[model samples]
Target: MNKDSAQTALLWIVAAGFFMQSLDTTIVNTALPSIANSLHVAPLAMQPIIIAYTLTMAMLTPASGWLADRFGTRRVYFVAILIFVLGSICCASAHTLGQLVIARVLQGVGGSMLLPIGRLAVLRSVSGEQYVSALAFISVAGQLGPIAGPTLGGWFVQDMTWHWIFLINVPIGAVGLYAVRRFLPTHGETQAPPFDFVGCGLLSLCMIAFSLSIEAPFSTHRAAWAAGLFVLAVVSALAYIPYARRRRNPLFKLALFSEPNFSVGLIGNLVCRIGSSAVPFLVPLLLQLQLGYSPLHSGLMMLPAALAGTVAKRWIAPLIRRYGYDTFLLVNTLIVGSSIVAFALITRGTPLAIEIAILAVFGAANSMQFAAMNSVTLKDLSHEDAGSGNSLFSMVQMLAIGLGVSIGGGLVNLFSAQWGSAALGFRFSFACVGVITLVSAWIFRQLDVAPAQPKVRAPATHSAGR
Candidate 1:
């Protein structure tokens, strides 16, 4: 019993790391406008602050597992916390937009390592019987971050200063650093094969090009620059395929996608997330700029969606079990997409209650879609593929978020130019992205009637993207 209790306490340490990483991802969104004003940059140009963090994470995530195996988990985890805390300090002290973006990149370097390595620690230490419960416990911390991040960010911006958003991590990270040294076990390094630096470079380049292209549409050389970047991005991504195929031990083996569902599921996830991820970034701006909502009020408005998403978790398993992954995902995708479209209709005169209801529906459906999609994508992977598959999925998830923000922001700017109104720009952008989401439903339709559910019991296990 004491041993079990000790393990449980250790899980809390892991959860704290997850919480800090997840919180930083979201906590800055509501504060973006305030941060821009403080830095003397336009609000729209601030997407790079958000993109830089997720993009850096995507670039570095593939190596996280290897780092833990090559070095001891405890040492690497301690350094990760140290770097993250120091990065937070840099972010608070940054005087210009370029300095802030650089700080975020540093923070992402640490954030990229935190959850995956912490998860590896838990998986190595805990028994199979205890794994699900331990993971579920840690995931609750991740979930709570989304719930608390916006509210905390808004309050800090309103009551104090935008810098407090980053400064708040100092104390939490300090305690986490100490806990890592005290409670974390000194595990032996694995005799894993040599790391694949070449493949990693190719994939990293691909992600950078693709992410940059999406943001190019908003630049001064909009058409020509976007075309050049788009072509380069395609070439780089395609280059990785042949390079991976020729390598002895690639970063992610091509065979992992032999299962039809995994391939389609991944493609669908990337496409669908490109639309859904933008809503969080765009919604706050819309509320503040068009609807005349305050930062605090906009943050509070997010509560209905986040709370409804939490409440909607229970509905997922039963629905999937009864209807199967294919039916559930197909139907749920439409609901999620349409709800996004419905947001385009919210004008200054729209009832607050009605707007909340629309957001709640989108939240519930999107949450359910993610859980189902994640399960189907990985449910078929063998134990050997589990680690790499999870890492690849995570990389794609972050990359999609960066792409989503870029695309949404670019589209808004484009439409704003055409319509001569930022409000109309937001409305048009929502509709276009919503349609993009709806098209992804066809990918889910390709799944077999009875799809495999993931063995991992926590509903949130597959929700790494969230």
Candidate 2:
């Protein structure tokens, strides 16, 4: 193929890889109840299935770039697709929650590699001028996954079974595998650097400890033990900072946070996403368990949010340009947080129009919030630090998603016990998460208003991080 056509094919191949990974993230959210039912577990207890995938991704992400460099990108990409498909099959066949969580971890092992390696491939092949368009094109593909995942999952669960939700990945993954072989160019493997096994272990332990701490209230752990675990988590996480500074080549350089925007944006992204991320998981549960919406209908309700987010992309640049990042993020963060809280207002008697409006507003604002946050975080990175910086950002994003599910689930159970009402529990969880989101505004407010450059769109990498 000619260079242009070949590059186009390469973008699609990477996009397809992204689509598969992205679809799995949301697709499972809608099917959580059904899967829980089939496994004879409580629907509320299904957070591990989601947490396992994200937490594993976060833990393993730092290794992906190194893996691509050690093993050629094409080879690693191919294996990633293969392993993800196999994990999907295992998930479909799972008879217990434990088995499914194990399978998801395996799936995450592959997914953690797919996009980073594929992006690496694109970076090596494409010229600088073409990079923006290429990334934009791939990002649009990533958006399609969120758009399709919930509805497709609901349809699969309703028409067939929850197993199909996983089985669906098989064919897509197989196609991706073949496309990688055919269209993807092979790259020379670089001299392998010494892997930071110690640093990675510390960070992984930190994430697990913190995540389990939030989840402890739901489990049999005592409050004191939970508090202790949280303390341990903080210690382990803090230990990594000092370790990174001492090491010659740490997994992530401590210096990356020196930029004001990077520091503010990363902190803001994590806090903001804790609330936003929980919404997807919570909404399905609210609609199905509380409002008595069918799985298909509940999934369909998500369409407005996805569609509005897509349509709102154009408005982001203009909005940011007019108000600047500081002003835009501060105001939009409130809108996003408020939109989340408004979901508590939805009841059996609530108007459908109001519900859709709430979701749509949150969708648009949240999308803008993400693109702006991502751009600002990476905007100040020097080209040399770009890869590591982006990888670190993506890792934190995944960590936040896992934390969001854990916190949201734990809150629901905590409230359910305290209030003696499941409906009240869901409502309280929404309000609590909304408040958490609002707190992130202070982080955004720290951004300088002068350098308030607008990001037209975020790359597939950041959007995929969502």
Candidate 3:
């Protein structure tokens, strides 16, 4: 093919990879109840399915860049598609929750590389002038995944079977594999720096320990295991400090924290997302299990939130410019938190219009919150630190998502058992998570009030394996 044709084909290839990855990130949420039934597990007990995939992605994301550089992008991308396809087949074939969780982990292993490597491929191939537009084009595919995932999952679960939620990826992955081999350029491997495997392990351990601790409430020996894991998490986190400091090329430089906004924004992102991330996981269950909505209806209800979030993205820059990061994040965080809390009031008696409005308002505020948080966190990073800082930020974002689901599911399980009502449990879970989000407002308050500079990079939106 000609140069222009090759580049265009490359874009299509990468976009397809992105669509597959992003689609899987959300496609399983609406199918959880069905899958739980199939696997003979409680619906609330299914958080591990989501947690396994997200946490695996979180743990492996930092390695994706290194792997791409060590191996050629085309080779790695091809392998990634192959593994993802295999994982999807395994998921469809799973008869037990254990088998499904293992399959999801395999899927996460591939997903963890897809977007990062795909973006890297585009960066190498596309001209600098066209880079932003190319990314914007790819991002549309990412956005469409979340928008289409739930409804598609619902339709499959209702009309066919929950297995199709995963089976659907087989055709997409087949096409992606063909495209990768045929269209993607062999960029050839470059010698990369020694990866900070130890540092990465420590951080990954910290995240895993913490997540497992949250999940321990469901275990028979909850207290002892939870305490031990929580302590392990804290110790693992502390161990990384001196370890990173001594290394010539650490996983992430501690100096990145010197930027006031970076520190505040990172903390706020972690804390705030712990609440908001649970909404996607919890809302579907709330609609179907508690409110008696069908799978399709539950999935359809998510449309308002997703659409509102898309529309609200355009408003983020203007609002931040007007109010400054400190003011914008503080106020927007409250709105987001309030919106999450308001879900507690949702019930069969609640008007459909009122529920839709709540979803829309939450969607807008949460979208702005992510954009503003991401921009402020990375805005001040020096050129030298930008890449590492961004990688660490992405890892934390995925970690937060896993934690949110773990905590949300744990809370519901705990509360339902105690309160003897699943409905009350869902309400209490919303309230708890909402309060967690509200606490982040204090973190955002620490940002010095200054005129908001235009974002140096696009706000990191949720993608499959970001």
Residue 312's lDDT within candidate 3 is 86
lDDT of 1 at 189: 82
Report the number of backbone clashes for model 1: 0
Count clashes in each candidate, considering only residues at least 3 apart in sequence or on different chains: 0, 0, 0
Error of 3 at 392 (Å): 0.6
lDDT by residue (tens digit), candidate 2, 103-125: 99999999888887888899999
Off by over 4 Å in 1: 449-465
- Writing each residue's lDDT as its tens digit, candidate 1 over 244-363 gives 889889999988888787788789989999898899999888888789888888888888888888889888887887778888888999998999989899999999899999989988
TM-score of candidate 2 to 2 decimals? 0.97
In candidate 3, position 128 carries an lDDT of 99
Error of 3 at 284 (Å): 0.8
Candidate 2: segments with Cα more than 4 A from true spot: 456-462
Error of 3 at 185 (Å): 1.1
